[model samples]
Target: GTRGPLAGIRNLGATCYINSLVQSLFMTPEFRAHILQWRFEPQQRHAMNLAYQLQMLFKRMAHPSRGFVDAKAFVDSFGMGTAAYRQQHDVQELNRQLLDVVQTFIDKAGTEQVLKRLYEGQFYDYKRCKRCGSVTATPSPYQDLSVAIQEISNLPQALKAFTTPDEIDGVSCDTCNDKTTVEKGLTYRTFPQVLTIQLRRIDYNRTTFERERVRQDVHLPLDVDVSELIEKSVVGSPNASDDQDENRFELQTVIAHSGTAYFGHYYAFTRVKRVERDAAVEAKRLEEGEDATEATVGGEWIKFNDERVTVATPEEVEEYIDPASWKRRHVVHATKKKAAEKTKRDAEKKKEADNNDSNNVNDGGDAPKDATEPVTDVATTTTEGAANATPSGNAGMGTPVATDEAFAFGADLFDNTGAGGGGDSDAVAEKSVSGSSYYAIYRRVDLPLPSATIDTASLDVPEYVLEATKTEDDELSRDAAELASLRSVVSVGLVYRGKKHWVSCKPETTLHELTSTARQVFGIEDTLHLRLRAFSATMSVLGATYPADFTMADTGATPGSSFTLLGVEATTDAAIAKDVWPTQSITEWDRLMPIRVYQPEKETFAYLRDLV
Candidate 1:
């Protein structure tokens, strides 16, 4: 095959559904090599081994003419035969079966446990007695996790709900020897090189006796921190420091379903990156460098949509999981807006051109020969419109459209400055990096230094600025005041659906009050519970949890320091975020929201169909 990256595979009937997944695995260089190199000694009659078949299938897909072939033998190997093969099969089911065959057949690290080493994470299952305070910890390993997407959630929220402690209904403590209440929770102990999570999208409605699909969006952050969920983490306590490794994961890929559950198609977006040693340092350089000495080179993002492969530009990647961004209505709205703007521009240009012609005729043979004179278009433009309007003179002079400012994503979505710096910013330009020799030891805290504060309000204007920028400075000052208010109050930073938001409140504020503010922000219908999340190593913060009565002061975090607020459902254990036991419900709330749980192994999407 010609090198660089392999071409998209052609579909072979319904077999192409699995081909989408196969293509996803093909892109993963490490896993691809691991599977390809694994030897399966047993030969099953005239048919090829599953590994060999997958190897051959990928090999064929790599070619141009023979892009893909029907996997008649591969499907037959499942043993369900034509009956199951002819009918539609769940993608999750196929994924589980495929992985099971490989994992079971290929025991490369017989004693070491190859599959677990690569995909599994061990958890300490804790059961604590209420009477004696005695705790029992059981080490259980889980290869994959299926997170229930309660309301609208992101990756971290789903994970927190999964790893958060659950209540053991009825269990007797061994030490106490009494059938009293016991609190159960899962503490993350060990993780893998590659972590795979399935967002449970299929929900069964008992009333209708039908499976419903949840199309709510979940945003994936650039970095995912699983440290606070780990049992050894001290973030929820008073002594949680900033030194612990959070086991942060940089999101490399996202496989998304774009349509309804029954008729939906699957596509994937992938960013080429690896977890760097230092997150802070890595955050500084989000793009690859040109230096050959660089250990890793990346930054390109590609969209794999079945046989249609294309570059997913930066803006497309930024709104990867935004539900609104993907809707056809959004596209229509943008199209109409552009059409209106063009219509207006065309009318104005016609008027301007007519005026220019009239002026030439009025002063016949007296007009200047130089065509570089200021045009009537600029003279007629409003202050606000002039700031955004393209220089009509450039078009008149026959300048190329490639260098046009009208095409940038302050208006032109494609005008991307790499993750590191800006296209026109002085800081990104050629400059020396030197700290002042005038370092000061302040006895007391001081205001922010001018050099340290970013002048984000400045526009690179060429003397012909619309306004004096005094209004912008005033706006920045107002924003600074607002930020100060956010810090001084309860100063809670709510992390939900993979986004962080800060809001101001009081220490005496009730859980309902905090959640009420959060609900308004997220526009969610479910009752939200505010739990104390670990202080991010990236930010100094407070720890706050529940008794439903405990105040923010109960966590012992200082005022004015930001607190981490994690949004959870009131139906789930409200105190799970703080690793505490929740009080019992008076009535059966399970009927309120009937949860259908299904798990078939790691890398498999959990569907209610698998259960029923």
Candidate 2:
């Protein structure tokens, strides 16, 4: 069992980015224990203190009776204004700001450098001048790595690319006194107990003058080793050990985005530990009448989606890694669908035959319970659910209803479709789960716990948290009836001039209505005629213009499907410009062959060349 029931964070508007980061941080065992044990001084204990607010939030999250907790207090203390809360910001930015604020507060409170001890690491930026052979090594500190992942296949590959040496264009060498290229790269000087990596999935396209997303799915593993990436000079030195076993890390949590570069939803997958100690060791300690803390290295996985927290299989977690994996999960397999239909028909026929046989037999007690599949086991439950729910017509916009495995949190807690579809035909809206991974957190393997146990007395929830909880409960009671209407409204992106703006509407909204809404979002006047073209998530060939009166439901246009609205006048201008000065290349033959070519308005190509 977990130390406490898992809890989710309420989204304060477009605050999914913050919620995802907070969930991952809360799951970090070392970080959680340290924050809980920090004894705040009289002066440091205040509502404005970020560390105190975060500690209180964590304490509420660990409450046994709560399904979720409100983070508005903490968010307010974090200083993200109400306007910022309504707009989506990058998760990495929040991660850095939160850590920095906590570090600042910890310093003021005169506590140990908890953030530095767990999340900070040192690296060297070295430049070797080829001419002078002089090397300059600059040591720098970092709490996390922001790495470019374009064209990279995995975590290690991305790290390697980040550290790859690049030549400099010009420099005055200190020894050689010449401007020449120099090889520069990075190497790890020390590894932190917890490592946070931010995958930069968005890139700027110079030609388009807009930010575009790299939809490549990079493979992530349960464990990662950075020993090989350490500086060669430090490996055998007294500063570092030759055998760097401590450099290994295990996946603790992941924060993934699920939309385009302009807008998206954020969610997290976290590894939850049930027991933190070896069973034999714990048993022996208990037998000796010593207090033994429940701890373990192995753990189950869970997903935190806004206010919904549920158990997630290791396989299901992979779906959030990248666009390819997410798209693969939504593909409609015709063969499998047909086979499932056939199986259902056969089962019905068998049931009819069994009923006929029962009518002839005199012995009728009850159906054997042994024939039914066991529901107690997790794997068994998942298999049974999958068998009953096969891919159906709603595969385009909704997930297979039968595949939602029930757990303590309830199966209906999450809207399976990213577009807010609740497994109903009327609400069958397509969801775009295909997006690049945004953030990941890793814990050092075999990291030793603090020598002194955390003081349980210091882990009390603050009064502010209690008051906030009551307010949240009241709000929830009032908003319960409005959730259905909220789910029916889905957001789709409208692209113009290489930029995407999202517009919200129901699935039954017509193309004309959608266009009108999109135009308003873009602040376009009614006089400008707009040309609409649709494209798949993968940027497939642009589909033909849709009829203005056709509803989104009729064409199965789901959330994240891009509809480009091109102004008729702007498009015509581009076409005319292209035709006026179409790029032409001059053709000439060698002097020895001296040839000139000319053509009359109606002359054939062969005749024109001969005449020239």
Candidate 3:
């Protein structure tokens, strides 16, 4: 978790599901600003008024009075009934209901256009008769789209699956008196400024007759083409943009759920778009001799987990979605291993070329400007740990590898630059999020952000809120002071066998102390000797071997940094055993690390032996 700048929401009992939804919406700048700009009438001001409570919650979250704000007031005012308030509620269901309530409140205020302008989308579910050649269209309005997760590896695939046409057999057509097969599917009539998608990960199992959560990994693109998913051939379809830029939608928020259908915890990772302050703020910065262009803040993502909000990387968000996907972990290791081997080969080739050039120069001949072999740009994969990459092959022969250090945690393991080498590095840098995304928010690039019609300064500020702000300011000052005085203790990870474990140590803690702690934690006997090596999961390659005399200060080890332990084997049978698959009851199967097996649809159960 990060100690970065963003306020959090405190969960009141089993209210984390609510907290996740609240935080995600608050981080959407345009929406937050719109809510804060609401002008409530004197008669509408009441303790049970949802809109007023929401405005207050957004006000406090934007200008946090403390590290976290109490959301109990908003919860009490939500009017979700007593039973719903007392327990954890489904996020998707609550999300739609909350929007409906907000729309209702704004409708009375005559500003309901804000909700429609930001979220409302029109779609048509159509059926075409084959015999009579007649088409029927049913127009519907939706604020969000719920897509299925079955048989899809990514979001685009899921969208296509949702919109793809299927045959409806033995159906009576309105135009045709006899039954005939009909083509049935949905097409977009209009797209919204902001699009929300819910990945339907929970499906009913036919064998067990129960609903179960699907743990399949579904990749979520940072930018998606909404136009491509729409059926353009339909007569009244929204005009498809010839310019691809206008069709793009960038991701803003991801609400991830962890645990089972009965019990689960919800958290959100939201993107903070760059903000441009007014001229007055810019003038103030200029007067202080600060860079005028430094008026903008944000353009980063943050994780909101109940009372603890921290700065988050895209990789961290991806990993949090499907932390136990073995394929993702394996791809990371395999890609790193390939990159390391390439580096070594490139180094050896460079040395040989240098020696050959020296020999040619000694013989009074000019050295070649470029190598005879063709050159290619190779991408690197990284993880939570830090990594670096140098250009491979001959010098001055090809484009230097533009590394995206952010491509970590099961993203495209290697950022393939593709053929032309001119692809935008920034675009490649933010990899697609993978896993079961319960909720996703995307904003259209062509649409302008919402602007406030009323002046924010005229709003009456609460006295208690002012006092809380003062207290928060004092806390910030104390935190800054504590940060200046560096603490002695720090935590780092130790990867032993196939698992990683974290241990605490001081900056001055020697390699000897680290090894001793590792031994104690891993329950290794004193007789057995352990070897310590500096390893990076980011590179999936080993670093310089450390001597017992080396200290953490010497190595510059910090929090979230990890090392690998070598020269050790499993001490017991339990350590070597793997979790077996449950054949009888599917519910009893391990959800995170399920046993590998052949495709049930394509092969028999006997094929499992071959896979094992």
Candidate 4:
């Protein structure tokens, strides 16, 4: 048995092969379905997949054909029936060849279109010279129309039809000879302002498509500067951070993407306002004896020697010289010395007249009986008194009596004393009253009052302590009795809240002032209640419970009966008739809403809420 198995292995070379029939039987419908399901869907994707598969299949089938097997062989190896395999292979080959031709046409057309768009809307035609191969550009269709037409007529009708007029001029380079011409035709197509490119992808029965659009604003015609637009829109995004390197990179990318050359749809049409040259007229002007510089050619006038020329009218002069230049030369004529002298003389004369007027008026509307005589005997007496008033041992006498009188009548004159003495009795009285009040309080408390004196030694309290104490007393007065007294005088309630909020019915008092005070003290959102009323004898007496200094007694006397609140209708008819105080109108009260108070120290409304 061992010798038999070894002998068969040597002769057959241990061959292992499956029969075609067995392979076909093993290829189930489920395996074929799996292959078909994975097939690429879009035409492009499908073609690519097929190409790859063919390459792989050829590699495995390498031999004399180097694995480049035909489509027929590929189908047969897949176990497809012979007839179906042949038919499918033929169809696929035809489709592959057709696609190759279509791709070539598409590539050619795309290149041509791009070139045409680049040269669109150009006014000039460009060509190379045949003689020297030098490039030239020209505006008109024919460089020399007369010569080109003559040459065209010499040609046969059939040849002439094929020829086009030459437009470019020859460049006068040293290497070029001006004898030959190159014949070429220029054709162009303009590009649209906005270009949209659509990209499509399809795979495994799924498709995705995206469209990208690029737009350009042609701000100016041909050869115009677009640097600003490029710097702004192309260089950076409007929202990009200035401090980031990425922002700079993004800006550069955008600029590079948008900086492509574009030939617009329409040609720029421009007409230069050229100043014509008139050689003959200018030559004639030069020949004239009158200054050549003053001569004019055509409508333009010339100037010479800085001399003024007589013109028929101001308009003629203006036409010859710039209007702005004429105005600068003619207007605002004045010399500094003349202006200063005039001002000085006028001031001097005014001073003299004022002195004369003063002397006449002081002389009782009459000229002085003796010019240089003393104006009054009182002046002499005053001078004598001042001279005698000086102390005996003083180095100099007191100010001259006449000078003193002059000083009194002039700017620096004032009495710094009280009555006949240079001391303030009222100030002393005020200080004494304050001291006596404080002393009386201290005596009652059995704490000795500090001594009252003008010198610093007499004061025992520190300056800051004294200031703080005074401030505290002032604040206390303001918060309580003073504030209540002021409110009564104004006839306005300062309470903040409820109906009749921030309404002032008091005479000569406005709703604005009451609400303003509430906002200042409470907050913008705080509610306030204010009421105005005609004073009644009883309420007026009760108001007097505050202080006379804070009452509005000047407004009017209070009646002995009940007072009525103006602008506020009573809630009910019975209430209106009754002698009760009226509240504010419901509408006015509804307008106010509470606001969160702004507290600077605590930096929030938390402190305000806690205080409330």
TM-score of each: 0.47, 0.53, 0.54, 0.13
What's model 4's TM-score?
A: 0.13
lDDT of each candidate versus the true structure: 0.50, 0.64, 0.64, 0.27
Q: Output the lDDT of residue 106, model 3.
A: 67
Query: Candidate 2 on 69-127: residue-level lDDT in tens?
Result: 88988888867678658899888888888888877766455667878988888888778
Q: Which window of ten consecutive residues has the lowest lDDT sum in model 2?
A: 580-589
- Candidate 1 stretches with Cα past 4 Å from truth are 1-4, 40-48, 62-72, 83-86, 108-112, 168-170, 233-246, 273-298, 315-319, 322-612
Question: How far is 171's C-alpha from truth in model 3 (Å)?
Answer: 4.8
lDDT of 3 by residue, 233-271 (tens): 665464534566556887677898887766678888876
Better of 1 and 3 by TM-score: 3
Candidate 4 residues lying further than 4 Å off, grouped into runs, are 1-120, 123-612
lDDT of 3 at 171: 98
3 versus 4: better lDDT goes to: 3
Candidate 1: C-alpha RMSD to true structure equals: 37.0
Model 4 lDDT at residue 25: 11
Regions more than 4 Å wrong, model 2? 1-4, 108-111, 175-179, 233-243, 273-299, 321-436, 448-612
lDDT string, candidate 4, 1-612, tens digits: 011000000011110111111111111122112222232223533233433233222222211111112233323333434443223222112323422432343324434332122111222244555665554444322111111111221212212232234544544444454544563433111111111111111112224343222221111110111112111221122322233221111000000011111111100001111123355774453343122221221122211000111112222222222222222222212233345656896699799999998886787655557888656677667767665766566615664466656345433245333355554222211110000000000001111111111122232333332342456445554666654544444333343333223333344444334434445654543332332222223322111111112222322423222232222221234433232222222222122322123234553332212333
**Local distance difference test, candidate 3:** 0.64
